[model samples]
Target: METSERIAQRLRQFGELEATTSPLYRRLAPLAAARPELVALLRERRSGQPPANVLLAALQRRLMARPEAPLRGYFATLGGTRAPDDELATAFDAFWPGELDALAGLVRTRRVATNEVRRAAVLRLAYVAVARRLVERERPPTAHLVEIGASAGLLLAWDRFAYRYGSAGFGDPDAPVTLTTTWRGTVPPDPHAPFTVAERLGVDVEPVDLDDPEAAAWLRALIWPEHVERAAAFDAAGAVVRRLGVTVRAADALTFLPGGLDALPGGLPAVVVHAFTVNQFSDAMRRAFDQALGEAARTRPIYRVGLEWAPGGARLELTTYPGGRTTLLARADPHGAWVEPLEDEPATTSR
Candidate 1:
């Protein structure tokens, strides 16, 4: 297909999928519309042959807009849904012609392209929904969670923010859900009643090494397109992650996780553990990690928590052992952002 047609189609898909009937989506629609030249600019630069960086940089410019010039010494990281198009991959191989890092630089020009990456966002939303489920289901007199994807982990420290739960005041009473966390169910557990994220330990394939300026720039780039608050949150979280230098087992998740399962620290009271939204990896990797957790949990009782995707809705599942059956902790708003527990069933059913 012509590059323009392909780019146009991809843009349309983003418009539909990114909108949530919530403020974020409504705002993104016009933001996208305002950039029509994006399609033509990217398409005109398309090539049927070699010199990879040359071709990609042109198309990439359509999607990216650097905040400043003089990139004389900065580095670029190329992250995206692993689902690279086969044809595009072939072209990339031929074009950049072996200058990998240089090409990553060319590709990292801040394109609207990655915004089309819905799968990861879906996984992220799933994790958030499930965390709420676990909280409500395991409503200890009070509770706190430690998360691993704390990109800003600020979201991990969510209870710290203000929010509304039915009529009662859950958030700080000072802050409200300016982002609109709507839901349709028995309302979720209200906040500030005594919840905290004592800590957040995040792992990334190429973790931003918060101390490194270049890494910090890549982290900033990953912040969602226009959500200034989220962007700020990422910056705050990035600082914490950098300072805390989390027990970040440093390797791609596949290599880092199995040992991480075995290395779980002993002795903690009232701890519910989880991952926010890193489930966008291959099925093989997910299974390997799940198996490792199961094996490790045989003696230890860390709940293997997942706020991951299913077909129609998101779900929260907890597994303490492989033999231990996993339960659907709750069904969440596909887009609304939190999981309220369906606790008609007793919590001890699994415990």
Candidate 2:
């Protein structure tokens, strides 16, 4: 159990972090902080998960279930028209108490697995760069795409979605989902680059099954209340995944990675990718991940495209193994709202 003081501190910090991005969460944080009973709900979170996010997601889940709930007015995703204001706290206070048990269960059992579809924009660029490198080495531009911590495997269908990077466009124009990102610094590799996803597989400890309505609703609830665009993109991507029947295997990434790579047909390289997933890993787990990649690299080349948190911010990076060389591709919004290219050549060592 967390102390009341710790809960309050976490809520305050979370509120500040959301101040610029999510108005509803930003407003609720301080209000939730002031209520000890409300803040204490975070005590049920799983180890290594952020208490504030878990608590908020729990509350949002309840609101999502009860469309008639007054708190729904504060959530734009639920067609809430009321803007963030003082009344937001009253709405939450009224709605949450009635569903305390359900909320607690959700917080305890659910993981915040946001399958942000827009991230395909960043991943597309990284894949293009990887393809260019493969072609330079006189290898096939085909890849067996394997993603770690792929929640619903929505991103695995990246090539199925359309993208617009500034004025340039790529992918199927008639695709169900179209992702656009603000591109910065130097021209991106040929948007017309040849790259093929020969196979798609994702590994996650708790992969969301889009076929299940309850599970899918929880994934939708994980999105911030104000991010209607993200919710729309998610639905579109989910549709694509269901249509394509993408596979997300339920397994721990570190343990499954080597075998997952080895299982793929030889000749076609494996492009291992992940986004906002490594932050959950422990120091030991990270080392094990590196070891797994190193072990996999002995037989065939491995390329890892990651959009993970860096010291500066979230970085879009491509690391090639056997050589262990890393290329700092760009700095990007964790949700793929924008990307600022580094313009530097691929590094000889891991960065």
lDDT: worst 10-residue window of model 2: 185-194
> Each model's TM-score, in the order given?
0.54, 0.92
lDDT of 2: 0.84
Clashes of each: 12, 0
Q: Write the per-residue lDDT of candidate 1 for residues 1-351, one digit (tens) a residue.
A: 455556555545555664342233233333333444444443443243212222233333323343232221121222222222334334332333333344345443422211111122222333343345446657432322444443433334344344433443443455322234444456544332343334345444533355656445544554343344554445544454445455433456556554554444444222234443445657776677667656655644444556555666666665545354566656554432544555433243443
Q: What tens digits encode model 2's per-residue C-alpha lDDT throughout 153-185?
A: 999998889888888888788988999888875
Q: What lDDT would candidate 1 get against the real structure?
A: 0.41
Candidate with maximal TM-score:
2
Off by over 4 Å in 2: 348-351
Please give the CA lDDT of all the candidate structures.
0.41, 0.84
